[model samples]
Target: MKEKIESKLREKFPNAILEVNDFRGDLTFLVDKNSIVEICKFLRDDEELSFDLLVDLCGVDRAKRKDRFEVVYHIVSLKNRYRVRLKVRVDEKDCVVDSVTSVYPTANWHERETYDMFGITFRNHPDLRRMYMPEEFEYYPLRKDFPLMGIPGSLQLPKR
Candidate 1:
């Protein structure tokens, strides 16, 4: 099944898929950020693959890598009972990628949370606002460089 999926993905987007990995039966595909939406749509709509459920969406801060951020998506095919993970590498300077809400509406909140925690923006997201942090908060707490104590005066507590 992994081989079939990988072959199909390669056939569909030969240039967009950067790497493929299978570890302990889990399949992971590292793909180009530019075509993430298209690739996801294919995974969901393709009858042979049919990755219908968007299980999770999150971000990883790769501070030292050429691409400083990685947006990860976990998808499952209910019909086939197969799961696959997709990742898109995002450059720190850009820190932006197209929202997958169109492909999977569940990604709306996930994307917002990723944005709030990692400062990675999802372009074209219906509501790309802070999910866990206050609207006025300035720093992304999950980034590697974010100070553990946080920015001075960034948060104001009510006077006791």
Candidate 2:
């Protein structure tokens, strides 16, 4: 099944797939960021693939790497009972990626939360805003560089 999926992806988008891995039955693909939306659309629309469920979408802070961030997507084909993990590397300087909301509506809240916590923006998101933090807050709390003590006086506390 993994071989079939990889072959199809290669045939459709030759250079878009950077790497493929299968570890302990987990299929993973590291793909080009530029073609992510198209890739996702194909995954869902392809009759043989039919990855209908977007299980999770997340932002990872790889603090010390040249590409300091990664956007990961986990999708499952309910009909085929197979799962795949897709990853796209994102540099800190350019922390935006194309949204998958059009393919999977559930990505809406996940993208919002990732933006709120890790400060990775989702391009073309219907409503992209901080989920937990105030609109005016400057720091991303979940960032690796965020101070352990919290940003002093960043959030106003109401008097008791």
Candidate 3:
């Protein structure tokens, strides 16, 4: 079943460079960021693999690794009764990936949360504003190098 699905995906998405891995029960394929939209379109529109649900989209910070961030897209095929994960690695300095909101409108809030927490920008996202973070936050707190302590005495809490 997995082989057939993979073959269909490869045929539909010619530019999608992927590394298939079936570790234990988890099924995932690491793909290039540039081909994300096309791959998603194929998944959702293909009659055989009608992945109608975009379950989730998330960002992971791999600070120690060369590829600093990875964006994970989870989709469920209602017709095929299968699930798949697509991952794309992006560097810290240029952590920009194509938005899937056009393919899946439910991805709006999820993408916003990812952008808020990890500073992974989704290019062409219609409403890419901070979701869970204070608007005044100058930097992303979830990053490894973010300061743990408060700023030096600018607004100290009255000797408490």
Give the number of the best model, judged by TM-score.
1
Candidate order by lDDT, highest to lowest?
Answer: 1, 2, 3
2 or 3, greater by TM-score = 2
lDDT per prediction? 0.95, 0.94, 0.85
lDDT of 3 by residue, 8-42 (tens): 87776666756888988668989888989988988
Global local distance difference test of model 1 = 0.95
Candidate 2 regions with alpha-carbon error over 4 angstroms = none
**Candidate 2 weakest ten by summed lDDT:** 142-151
Across residues 1-160, which tens digit of lDDT does each residue of candidate 1 receive? 8888989999999999999988998899999999999999999999988999999999999889998999999999998999999999999889899999999999999999999999999999998899998999998999999989999999999999
Candidate 3: clashing pairs of residues: none
The lowest-lDDT stretch of 10 consecutive residues in candidate 3 is 150-159
Q: Rank the candidates by TM-score, best first.
A: 1, 2, 3
